[model samples]
Target: MKAPYIFNIQKFSVHDGPGIRTTIFFKGCPIRCLWCHNPESQKYNQEVMLTSEGEEEIVGQHYTIEQIVKKVQSDQIFYDQSGGGVTFSGGEVMTQPIDYIVELASRIKRLGISLMIDTCGVAPVENYQKILPYADGFLYDLKFINSQDHFKYVGKDNSLVKDNLKFISDNGGAIYLRLILLKGINDSMDTMEKTVEWLKENNIKISEIDLLPYHDFGRDKYNRLGRKCTQNFEVPDEQHVLNIKYYLQQEGYNVKIGG
Candidate 1:
């Protein structure tokens, strides 16, 4: 397989996963979440961004598996010392060519580096199965449990996402749940309760649940790309975020404020 389209290669990202890591931000996503921070990565094709300096800059670039491996290998020392490795993030990493992803993952595994796929869990179960062997684990995003709320907020149903999560869990795949806390959007008591209930019902055992507070940091990117920011959700305060964390903890789940 050839190189896939990538919007960015972020190095020394402490939030993506364990230790210090290099995050490959793949271009394109299936769902249009209201609170997406990297809007530039949503489109599959290359796009031009108008910079503040009146210059047109391309948003996506392609890199072969070998090229990406080389870039990731550069951080070998850090990974060896810190237990960190390569993380394939998005737009939605699964949105890329599955063949290319599997090839890339295989190469990463061959290098003996930890591999983590940060996904929204919107892809098919087969896609997850293909790469599961190469991946050390998954950073699965759980937006909304209710189908109607999920579609209204993320423009997609939750059935596939739920099914994928269950499949991974049942197969003994390591999962770390990531939930974006949007104020008055997906932060209600009902949502939290349902999320806990769903996890329990599916018998999914996750290492940790990361509660990511919603932020408008991507608003500027939307403007630079000449795209409309349709969602105006507010970020949850520290107390509210802690409260939800506490709730999850009370339910016997290990929860953290941020990833």
Candidate 2:
């Protein structure tokens, strides 16, 4: 009754969170960001992917909370060793049935394992409120500050996003703000300053700011779907990131590359 339209399950991912983790990538997103690396995750329905052998539909066996716990517990040895547990990524994790997210997160918390959610913060505050108690930390993504820029590039105005971030921060949500460094899109000093200003205005002390470099991983998928790929924008080199970091540091904010 509470099944989510899930797409992929990745095991042993280190880059997503602390130590080793199993990331559950759910399906469906409200905003279609041009630079999304996982374009396959944009749809709510299960999609078919071609493999060497044949076609593969992404729908798999659904696991209940207890069932999923077994798989997560199997990684307990790793969890104990690396301080990693599970991360709920998505199309948008909060976009799923709140009951499902709450049930799953509550179970994981009961296990004393660290649970994290990587969100675009486009969903309702009630959704965030439901999962906030269970989350040990949040990987909060902020793409653009200007409403029009956000609408053009990300396909949605960010007023709700801003409110959600403020809501979470005001309620004492432990968060690491994630900003993707796109060459011509969000890398300008004006955009960066606006982002910094938003953070400052919220009185949110950044635990860390992860500057993600845009890549072209989703180009082939877009091609396969018969859709024109648009996120092939240039990426900032290491030096460029360094300059941005210097600017953030000068503003009294600590910055880092990659979350």
Candidate 2 local lDDT, 158-226, one digit each (tens)? 998889888888888888888888897789888888888878887876677878888777677765655
Top-scoring candidate (lDDT): 1
lDDT of 1 at 9: 97
**What TM-score does model 2 achieve against the real structure?**
0.94
Model 1 TM-score relative to the real fold? 0.97
Off by over 4 Å in 1: none
lDDT of 2 at 133: 94
Each candidate structure's TM-score, on Cα atoms with residue i matched to residue i, is 0.97, 0.94
Error of 1 at 152 (Å): 0.7
Estimate the lDDT of model 1: 0.89
lDDT of 1 by residue, 34-98 (tens): 77888888999999998878699998998877789999999999999999999999989886789
